[model samples]
Target: MPINKQQVRTALTHVMHPEMEKDLVTLDMIEDLIVQDSFITFTIDLPEKNSQLESHLKEKCEEAIRTYVDEGAVLDVTTAVNISKFRDREDGRGEEQAFPGQGHRKKKKRQKDEGEEELLSGVKNVIAVASGKGGVGKSTVAVNLACGLARTGAKVGLLDTDIYGPSIPTMMDTHERPNITTQKKLIPLKKYGIRFLSMGLLVDPDQAMIWRGPMVTSAVKQFMEEVEWGELDYLVLDLPPGTGDIQLTLVQTVPLTGAVIVSTPQTVALDDARKGVAMFKKVNVPVLGLVENMAYFIPEDRPGKKYHIFGKHGARDLAERIGANFLGEIPLEQAVRESGDAGKPIVLEEGLESRSAQAFVELSNNVIQQLAIRNQSKDPTEKIDIKIRP
Candidate 1:
């Protein structure tokens, strides 16, 4: 059998860019991959002029070809160092590719009228799970919500947009690499009845991402446009903590259905969650509701008792005050944490008696119900009014 581009790209997904904490192919760093006869040659666009990294990437690419291609296949890997400005593609899309952690470079914002026909064209609804702060179990909630929806027989896609801190790989418990489609689109990895993509699966396990605003935005754009997420009922984006580039960029790039803000029941967390809701509202993305994770703790001996560890119903109250729907509360449980670490979300547990699992299942149901309501009353004129001033 002759060597093929798909095989080469699949192998390169394992060859991660050390600093970016992502695979070369997904980063669009691997360009002009041409296979003629028994020889393969490709160009890698490096972020900076680092000879050490350049040499390392070249060796890895060569190794990938050697491992995947038949014997006697010659590989010519070349490096193109780009340390300054973002490069525009010849395709005239006005999109610039930014290298992860590259010093900040300015790129023109996408035109408002540019439709999403090329990206997210087949997705029915895109929901984002966000938080104002970290360690509030946002990613956990996202994973379970996705699994819960999938359990209901819906075709789902989970996208980890947390470039700075990706957790889907560990939470989903799958190490599968993505495959490239014949049309040059990346196919998401599937496991436990859910399709998912995460930077965690693309990079070395211990590597950290030190990306700038543009770099993060670029990556999220690629995840939306390059990945072939065909006909999904729901595409749950697990966003990073805070209201920054990733959040704003996503809302502007895709027509989001709504957002689910997660927070512990506490004054500090609620304050941040309020900001999160405001941010989404400012961007015209409806605030679906707030999920009060770690709402309380119940002792094994005193099964009937509810302890308000963080404070009772803080998120629920916040939701009511802001006029956003209140999704539900998730109690603090060891099983929730353990299951997440085990790569098996509590909602996917065999039995239906687990409290955490039940809470997530209920949350998913509420989200679906709310989405249905929004779709019924869906009106473009209802979008948040904000005029850009000259």
Candidate 2:
């Protein structure tokens, strides 16, 4: 029996657009699907070129179709972008003309103070890592989570938007300042297979950024618009501590796929984390989940002993109360801090599987799984409700 078109579409539905977090069929990404006998061919309409998602989608689609149809079926995949979406205004004869706002009598002058465009170029999904207040190890969690994702064969990028205290460069063991290309594009530093950009790279270590809100906004806008991230599967943004101007600017500027709020297992931290969740919800950015860092401290001498040094399950309780997903927790380990100081993230330490490291790995994997499930679900607004306690 010949393979059917409906069957091919069904298989394709299982495939997702990695960045959009939506099924290809629902997003109208699958184009030109043709099936004859056991041979099938299709085209995926990607938003841009050099997309890493193409290979992931192609591999998954082929595997899915082979399960239902003939095992030796051939699948051809091609990638192209829909350019007509960006076309300029058209006049009566379809020729480009001055927009309605600009009069035909005079050419519109370019404003000298025009703001930079909000283009998260080359990033498939932008995930912001935020906290309610400082001293919560928010940047630490962000750096390791990004590294963990990259270690799992996903192309990841880390943007340290903590203009006040950017720690990604130190935590990721990268110190070189980014160099601008002749085209005036900023190049991010690469470490452990993950590209990173930070304001820390631009200024002296001892210097403090004393700029006002507008200045900070401009600098952050430059970081987002000018950096060449180069086709990242996940761009993890380490937002500055607290919900301030920088956080507001980022949420308003970028089309964030979702956000992950990091908080320690303490009443103080949870109070702030609750506010963080409210902020993202108010802005309509999906909250992927909550990660409780330093949930507990495990003694090295007594492997079986666990200490609730920072109180217990504060974040988990908050997640439950707010009806949010509690992703997982990371125990307090000296190795986590030591690795950060040494500029080698715990996830990248060779063959060292401490409890904390394993927790991070598990947490990273769980995050991916949740995202995949959310992507496959029928309703886009449905939340993934996961409860965790310790």
Question: Best by TM-score, which number?
Answer: 1
lDDT of 2 by residue, 1-390 (tens): 767888888877887766678788887767656565566766665545555666777787788778866688977666554332113212233323211111111111122135633266345467789999797888888888898887655667898877788888889778887766444667677677677988888855344466666666667766787876655567888988888755765676665667899999888888889889988888777788999998998788998989989989989888999999998898899999999999988977777478778888887887776565554441222222222111
lDDT of 1 by residue, 1-390 (tens): 767888889989989888779898887888556665576767676655678998999998888778877557787677755332224344443433221211111111132345524356556667899999999999999999999887665657899877678889889888788766556777677677567999666654344366556666666676678887765667899988987765666566665778899999999988999989998888777778899999999987899998998998899999899899999999999999999899989999888688898999999999988876765554321222222222
Whole-model lDDT for model 2 versus the true structure?
0.72
Assess every candidate by TM-score: 0.68, 0.66
Window of ten residues with lowest summed lDDT in model 2:
100-109
lDDT of each: 0.76, 0.72
Error of 1 at 115 (Å): 12
Question: Model 1 residue 326 lDDT?
Answer: 95
Clashes of 2: 0
Which residue runs of candidate 1 sit more than 4 Å off their true CA positions?
Answer: 1-116, 203-208, 380-390
